[model samples]
Target chain A: MMDPQRLKYTREHEWVGLESPGVALIGITDYAQDQLGDVVYLALPEPGGRVVRLQKFGEVESVKSVSDLFSPVNGEVLAVNQALRDHPELVNQDPLGEGWLLRVRLANATELNTLMSKAEYERFLHREGG
Target chain B: MPELLRTSLYDAHKKLGAKMVDFHGWEMPLHYPAGILAEHRAVRNACGLFDVSHMGRIALRGQGAAALLDLLFTGEIDDLPLGKARYGFLCNEKGGIIDDVVVLSLAPQAFLLVCNAASWDRALGWVQQWSPRFEPVEIVPGREETAMIALQGPAAAERLETLAPGLSTSLPPFAVTSEVVAGLLVTVARTGYTGEDGFEFILGAKEGPDLWRALLKEGAAPCGLGARDTLRLEAGFRLHGQDMDEDTTPLEAALGRFVRMEKVFVGVEALREQKRAGLSRRLVGFTLEGHDIPRAGYAVRAEGQEIGRVTSGTFSPTLQRGIGLAYAPPRHAEPGTRIIVDIRGRDAPGKVVALPFYRRKQGESSLASL
Candidate 1:
């Protein structure tokens, strides 16, 4: 499946989609979830918490291993996916949509320019030989 | 590091879109397209096939074979009837476990050892060191020429019965027998790692891929070692070097019953002394509260003190809770005793529980007419 072209990506395989004028959504990429095997739990920051660009904000633990989730841009957490607390499998089934990790009020919206597009992210995954 | 070795079923696993990982230097499948959770459930519900050729298989033959085994093993081997299998451990002189293994009596003078691949080379060294005393015993390392497959689940018998007629109902638990299926001669043992009624097949290496494909045609879901780990964890089986190491005695590893105290074996004196003195720390089962997954090396606390560390832990697929085994101080080792696990710095509430985390209803999980 194609990653939505409108989304921006991180080298660590997180995606950021601008939801509104300075608000964006975040979640792991499909490749990230597939590599993790089976999502069992996620430890995400609560709303109102500040996150820095390229900083670890959460973790995704699967049946196989745990991976850190990094912030794609500096922002204040607007909301976290409460449903994922009990149903983390959503990250494996629909990572880009229903499995979105958080909504952030972007503090440095210019940071989006530094991120990769859908095609660039696909090329990065290939370069990594995945 | 050395290049990883591949089993006979490697191509078959790749054909199923399996994710291969390095397991003790062997390139083994970690999971298939269904993932570990689904594969674990499939084995608990229907049937799951596994390529377990990575386990070390060494055959001992000749007059001195049984005696050689009797002295090396913690349990009595002479009383084991022909075609029967016995579980025991290879222990050092200090009573520490080297490896837990299964010995199958192929004939009056022949025995087969199914051991952990991680322990194969070291365990073989110990055997050779003692072989000269038991002359005429042939230590044949057959792992290179053989392949093992495990078919587990409640439907294992019925599904396997379709291919090998009359085999399911006839083979009893812990029994080993020979059978011919799909033109391959396989030694079928009614033994398994999962807490289910199942069978393990040892056959020629060249025929492993064919047998795997044939089982798939019979509706067995191909499983990988990832599911195998969860299944064994729920079953309360100890993984070599993870759950127990050379420093952990059989008694401390919750394997006291496997060590026959009266047996004249290498580690008997130390075990006898430990039995007299007492266990300082006991390997026990514990369950954690919601979303608290206790992983290996996590601290286990009791009475506001860090008393031990978890050895094997996981989120139980069947029990739907966090379950694990850890070495616990005696006061906190009893069932229902309150304990806490330090999960990455968060102290999560837990309790000492009896193994295994999941138990099949009578006559379930195996083909014992279920």
Candidate 2:
């Protein structure tokens, strides 16, 4: 089981944490990273690209399959983890911290209320069973 | 309804925590807890065992069996000596591949044909259809009575030598012998899907679990369909359904060498016609320039025009590069030709290359000195 204390999560298994008021850090959950092993490449959206809730923002490639990254909240991309461009394994190594995929500015502050809390995310993880 | 087809070693696979998936209508294990990369590495560096009982096994025994088999398959089956095996294809009336199979000449008048499980019904029906004109023929319904296991990698021989004791050392590539491994009656064949010097053992269903445990105890890593796919792809071997289907002819798939027109077969005329007309599309191997992994059904583009689609693709663990096979236009099928694969709405550059990205060293007794 992964600790959900440090971040907020989406039902679709993405994690988002507020770096600042409007700026938020995002990456996949530990479960998601484990499901997609040994990430080889990551294609992130442009820094200024607009992202909407439940929409595809980028893609991650592993050895045998490729998975699409979905945005959890309506936001505009402020920055992306360029380190992932070469060493995508970072996502597998530290999904909660250094492996953060992108930073975005949330368009609406109310979006935070709908996000799942640590306890809620744990329940969700249990329900989904990874 | 989703029907689950279980192999002889289903309980053993479940005990090992294998991720099960539906493959060719069989509930086969995709990988174990260690995962595909680990299993592949184990098979490459050490020893690994696989349950391939899902494959079809048929027997042809009669006075005129050899003559009848020569008329059915594309390869020279009659020429195969007793106890030797040969790879061949079963083609349809229209010259398209029905199944790619292996024929083992167990005796002068008896042969064992191993085919893909999914095509068992069709192959059986085809043989039954031709049986009246030939001689007595028998088709085994399922491998349920038999349990198949593969011991692969560089150290596979040594491990087998220790486990079975003298049952694997004298074996040469493609050689077959019925020997007792772990006190179980098993037919050990020195042939495998991975491009490694290994052996594939066919044993009884009741003895499968005990044998699997004994093999694991002897350091044979448990592999699954995932590693099997990567290994076979790297070796440039074709999966029956993906590489060549009912619509795809053997000639178009670059398997012309396996088809011998010197003898009569079911689809000889159509294949001859296809050869005369020239191939429109051909199967080719390619590697993505970057880390983008092309998948099955991804389109292949040449100069902005859709030429073909990838049939099978995966990141080769041994090569450390994304590799795939596709049916592309004949013009772009040549080695060193460049093409772009549309990977999730983005174009990734790929180049055609010679197949079997890897090959194992020949055995000591092989025709070529190693």
Candidate 3:
């Protein structure tokens, strides 16, 4: 589990890391992958696609069902994790590292303030009773 | 909300930290902490134990029992020898499948019908309605008093022999016998839904917890419905509600072999007529070329036109690929035929393949007699 202090989280279970000025990396949280079980496929948007905060960008499919992956902040997709096409299990094995879904050029750096801190996300998980 | 029914091993599942889900009103374990993937692999490579008590068990006893089943089911059940089982379907007069069942002929004038859990009430009612026609035959519902556990995989027989000595060795495929295990009476049947050698034990409901623990102690991994579904799908077994329904005929479901044409049974005339006219569509199996998963209700296409729909689809744990069964027009049902599945609006390419996406290597024990 990655320290929630270093990353911001969305209520829909995605995590965001501001890598540099105007750039961010995103992936689903450990809690999300644990709930989804073993992921078999991931459908992601192509590079150069624009996304808005809380917008549906792609989907993560487990053996049992599919869940929509929601964008946490507005951005232009710089690249998707192409390794996921052949090894979706990485989402279950290394959700914080190799399982990272996308790298993006943030449209608005201020959008990060609206997201929850690691402490707040832990409380949110507790409240959800998961 | 209505009360959700639970099986005898409900507490056992909870103790193992299994994730429970409601399956047709039955509160059952969907998977355990090891998850579906590991549970499925356990059943294929080693052995897994499943609590199958939710499935309906109906007992028929009387001089007219065999005769009544022969008329009601599509298979020739009257001549089924004692201690053996036969797989067949109960069809409506129109030849549409009501339920696919397995009947175990326990003795003369006595038999047991095991039907799907979801179809229990309807199947029992259908049997009761026909019971009067065959005088002296009694239709007894046994689910409340009985519990069942399926021990399945390549190592199943070896694991079973350690618990009930000589029981697994004495039984051949599709054979059933009553034995006393740990001072409890158990009806051991050499049968399973997964494409592997295994046995299903039917015993007193109260004894379920004890046997479940004993099996676990003997190294049998506790599995849940998630593993059961993937295993059955890989074996090319058709789930009743998904693969066929009251509106789908057995002929269209590609289960014609289970139907005996020489015998008089419900829907025989309709099946005979279907044979004469030829089926317009038939069930076919396919494997996706890539990682995209085909799911139930997904449209199947050929030549840019919608030809059919997927009945059951899943990522086969054993084959490590996407596989499914679908109903397609006869022209598109042949092996090697090209077809595309509409996965969330995108067309994913796949090709029709032979039934049973996985078969155990030669010299492995046969799982089913049929």
Best by DockQ: 1
- Which prediction has the highest lDDT against the true structure? 3
**Deviation (Å) of B303 in candidate 1:** 1.5
The C-alpha local distance difference test score for the whole of candidate 1 amounts to 0.89
Tell me the deviation in Å of residue B320 in model 1: 1.5
Q: How well is each residue in B22-54 modelled by candidate 2, as lDDT tens digits?
A: 888899988887778889899878888898888
**Candidate ordering by TM-score (highest first):** 1, 3, 2
CA error at residue B74 for candidate 1, angstroms = 1.4
Worst 10 residues of 2 chain B by lDDT: B361-370
Q: For model 3, how does the per-residue alpha-carbon lDDT over A60-129 read when each residue is reduced to its tens digit?
A: 9899888999999999999999999888989988888888999999999989999999999999999999
Return the interface RMSD of model 2: 2.0
Q: What is each candidate's DockQ, to 2 decimals? A: 0.76, 0.50, 0.72
Query: How much does candidate 3 score in TM-score?
Result: 0.95
Worst 10 residues of 2 chain A by lDDT: A1-10
What is the per-residue lDDT of model 2 for residues A70-89, given as tens digits with 9 covering 90 to 100?
89889999999988876777
Weakest ten-residue segment in model 1 chain A by summed lDDT: A1-10
| Alpha-carbon RMSD, each predicted model | 2.2, 3.0, 2.1
Q: Considering DockQ, which of the candidate structures 1 and 3 is the better prediction for this target?
A: 1
Candidate 2 TM-score to native: 0.91
Off by over 4 Å in 2: A19-23, A34-38, A46-51, A75-99, A103-109, A118-130, B361-370
Classified by CAPRI criteria, candidate 3 counts as medium
- The candidate maximizing TM-score is 1
